[model samples]
Target: MQNVTVVDHPLVQHKLTIMRDKETSIAGFRVLLREIAHLLCYEVTRDLELEMISIKTPLETIEAPTLKGKKLVFASILRAGNGLLDGMLDLVPAARVAHIGIYRDHETLQPVEYYFKAPADIADRLVIVVDPMLATANSAIAAIERLKQRGANNLRFLCLLAAPEGVQKFNEAHPDVPVFTAAIDSHLNEKGYIVPGLGDAGDRMYGTR
Candidate 1:
């Protein structure tokens, strides 16, 4: 069985703990979310392919390793994903961004897509779909499906937290794409929410409900 990575970096773990606390204010939540996203992005992009190029330095000419090909397309799964986007952009300011919106249907508990947009050249870019939580895996799966349909083949999923059940479901549904998360919790509730998931990510980030 494929397993999702639970990043154990001290900075990631510390920020995640603070964000999980109910007493953490919206401002604090937003700040910490971005900070953790940056840390997580660092780990996720560690294996990005690099190419060496000759460059002229002030003192002498030298060879330097730089990223090859098109910049990555950071697709945010809307609202909460925006928090992660801010931090990731700080690390790779040149990367393009795409937005996808998905909401859970209260009655069916399935994902409903409200918006989807991406770069026309998605096929050639490394696409990283991001969300704060991976609960039932419905939204993430749906988002990836849409990306694939739009010709995005090289892809990855990034989240702040994930549930074991969701990770299993996601791997089964789309094993080609690896998932990275700060932590993988126990299981999901019947309502499709991850247990102790820091509450509704959209609501927590936006100060709603």
Candidate 2:
């Protein structure tokens, strides 16, 4: 079974607490979101492959381990994902970014893809798919499926907050990919929103609502 890492770092928890407060100002919320994203990205990339190579030091040559292969390709699930992308990029400044937009049909509640763009050689690079909230898992799953169709085999999922139901559904559907989140909430409400979630991430991030 693939692992679902819920980051318990003190900083992550602290930041999340602030972000959840209804009184948190828009600027404050935005800053905290980025900070938490950077912290989570650190833990998610801990096991990235590395290779040792000889390099010259001030005095003599020495072997030092450096990241191996191509740079990471971050596939953001549209507007909300862009919030997370800014922070992740701070950690891996050279990472390539892709965008995917999906919306849920009001009646059928099915995912509908509006946009998708990725690096030409996604299959050869580590791909991290990101979104702020993992609620119904419809958008995340659909985004993953689209990436797979584009030849992305090395992929993982990342989010700030997730519902247990969404996590279970996504993991069962894509057993080969792992998921990482700052916190996992209890469940989704009838309207498909995660309880105690930070609300619509795209709305909060862009002041859309």
Candidate 3:
């Protein structure tokens, strides 16, 4: 938990519980994911810099505080990452988006990128990478590596659930990139699934196997 933040608000916890329940319907799961992302977005963006600017407030002109610098970029790590995108976008409507498609090789359990696209001038903006589950950290690490290669420096990682092993590996790989998650599950099962996890977030969200 050194470089990780668990968003344990009552709302966040309640929504996460719904996501974890196998009996929950796909529509319900998707809705909860979006709702929880709204909360997580609030925590992740708490430190954004603000600058005072002159503004007219009905009667008089006063200095108003506004966000400084370029808009943030939300980088989604493939299919599952997209699940978190809509909710984050709902919170940061003006933020840019990037998509990185990385699939895990079943035999080796290594990440292999098939597609990557990002906004121009990423180096000058804050980039937040998103994925629903951080089970092995392979995809997250690889996605971050790809982002850095595209000149993205200021970065953060956000996810719905995280495993201890994944967090350790991710921190070791990219310590500068802080992690934000709703929950840190017990551990990963034999097949790299987080025990007591919401079970295949992408599948659950989209009703896909």
Candidate 4:
């Protein structure tokens, strides 16, 4: 898929494997998730535009290349997404943050929005939506839809793991929004969970389920 990017870096793959293990404790899983997120974030923003600016160093003034245009906006797709959000913030502290709270209806498997808050100038910045898992794509599609309704144009989706079905649905729903993932696992199960996924992301991260 043209819109999908899999960060296969050694470090990212290693951490992802550890995270996928059923024996990994909640504390350990959270730590590994954060570490993997940092690596994935690097790949997600690798193509950001840069502009030259004059800056004075300790010795002399010189032209320096800095990120161009408005500061980026990291949009977290609620609870589990925050796991990736926390680590990404460590890399780009200046970027604005947004939280999109959406949940899936258990029976219908539809998305339900509960809360959303984004930067006022969302239209002018690149918005990267973060989520730990992409299983059904219902929440992801709805989250991006909400962002667009609020005037966000430039957008991308980032996740720790993705199922092929979810990716296909997401691509069909929003072809313009590229997806970044550390790994794309097997198909989803009958219960809508990724076959080899790390279980419910929010549940695993919080030890709730």
RMSD of each: 1.0, 1.4, 0.8, 0.8
Question: What lDDT tens digits, residue by residue, belong to model 3 across residues 2-113?
Answer: 9999999999999898789999999999899999999999999999999999999889999999999999999999898887999999989999999999988867879999
| Residue pairs in candidate 1 whose N, alpha carbon or C atoms collide under 3 angstroms | none
Residue 192, model 4: Cα distance from true site in angstroms:
0.7
True-vs-predicted CA distance for residue 22, candidate 1, Å: 0.3
Q: Write the per-residue lDDT of candidate 2 for residues 96-192, one digit (tens) a residue.
A: 9999998877576678999999999999998999999998999999999999999999999999999988988998888888999988898898888
- lDDT string, candidate 1, 21-137, tens digits: 999999999999989988999988989999999999999999999998899999999878999999999999999999999888877879999999899999999999999999988
The list of candidate 3 runs beyond 4 A from truth reads none
Q: Give stretches of model 1 more than 4 Å off.
A: none
Better of 2 and 4 by lDDT: 4
TM values, all candidates? 0.97, 0.96, 0.98, 0.98
Candidate 2, poorest ten consecutive residues by summed lDDT: 102-111
Clashes of each: 0, 0, 0, 0
Candidate 4 — worst ten consecutive residues by lDDT sum? 103-112
List candidate 2 segments past 4 Å from native.
none
Output the lDDT of residue 54, model 2: 99
